[model samples]
Target: MIRPSILLAGAVSVFSPFVMAQDDENKPWTVSTELGVIATSGNTETTSVQGKIDAKQRLTRWHNHYIFSALFKEDQVTQDDGTKTTEKTAEKYFGSIKSAYQLESEHSNFFVFGSHTEDEFGSYETYSTVAVGYGTRLYNGETMQLDAEIGPGYFRGERVLEDESIQRESGVILRGAASLAWQISPSAEFKQTLSVESGEDNTRTVAESSLSTRINDAMQMKVGFNVANDTDVAPDKEKTDTMTYVNLVYNF
Candidate 1:
């Protein structure tokens, strides 16, 4: 078993030097919020909303990142008997935090990360993960950047069954992730992220892509698409889910 206390001590010991080497004046924090919504009426009635927040702080030796996002969707449909009803088709939320310790080599670091997720209709009531790994910048240039990371992790969750009973699942897993950023122009940028976690029970993968165009110094318009897949799921459950959004982002 991987003990959290041992992991914490190891991470602290490895990152302390970087933290001690940082100068005060160079540290800065960046934060942003994004909101999106879609609505339709008449023949088909639907409403969906999503919101996300991101924050990052970087020092000479350490970088920290945090993210939170939530989505809710409901649609109106007519029953086979001709009656109309409003049903909630989707609801999900996720949050994560990570910290990276800069190594002596440029563009390389060791990181610790954790995340939790909840979905109203998903296979699990709540899913959580913790990982530690090494990360490196694959490409960095004026207009584009790419980074990749790999590590070992643990996953534990309670799943919902058709009988309304809950079953617990826990396992050790491997995690791999990559991110890309492209500065298309002064006022526009594109981003993509991919992550995968595999364990004996199942493998999960997620991909997200988005483009943002600045409307002003403090705001931007963004279009994002996301896909999530699970290699193993209940017979009555789906193997994949996808979402699309048009978001307005505000920087603070």
Candidate 2:
């Protein structure tokens, strides 16, 4: 059963008149197929299917803006019984945009951003986070990237009976991600990723790595793993439970 909000989002997408009228030079889109698994400490494993969309446009000369993103599956879930099920799972979505300014040919790029994320197991909320970062081209084709931010944010829980804590941490945090794209042929590409994320109260650390291949102009596929830990995993209990998710992504 799809949630009301998921149905609403899809309806808006289908009826979005602006989506088709936007100038040829004004929009972009990406779609993908994703697969992954989530593990909690020594228990429960859930696998999932994932998909993503990204678009960009230059609103001005000083700031060539782009929104890079993706979201995927409700069930590709790996249950304790070791069977796959898509039932009772929730849909996930994420979108973000940034206005970047260039300072040099290969040395600097800076940006400010705002984003929204809705995970299969979490709430959907808007964020007005600001980031200043630098990017430099490396190895003639590969690139290195880094950024930092501070902001107030919101989150929601998926399970109604589960804990309901909406307001997330608000403080300075550092974010970094790097991907190496290998040009295999004129039309095909391969990518590898490395990322680390941290936030205030020294809470919630995320580390991830993945590999993907671009099969065509509209579609791509990925497989990866991610691990997350928090300072206060169980608010009422003294124990902390870490989570891991093995992921596969498809984009078109």
Taking the tens digit of each residue's C-alpha lDDT, what string does model 1 give over 24-45? 4364666677877666666777
Give the Cα-based TM-score of candidate 2 against the true structure: 0.51
Identify the candidate with maximal lDDT.
1
Best by TM-score: 1
Q: Which stretches of candidate 2 lie over 4 Å from their true place?
A: 1-49, 58-87, 120-128, 141-168, 203-232, 235-252
CA displacement after TM-score superposition, residue 173 of candidate 1 (Å): 0.6
Local distance difference test scores for all models: 0.82, 0.42
Query: What CA root-mean-square deviation does each model show from the true structure?
Result: 11.0, 8.9
Candidate 2, residue 65: the lDDT equals: 38
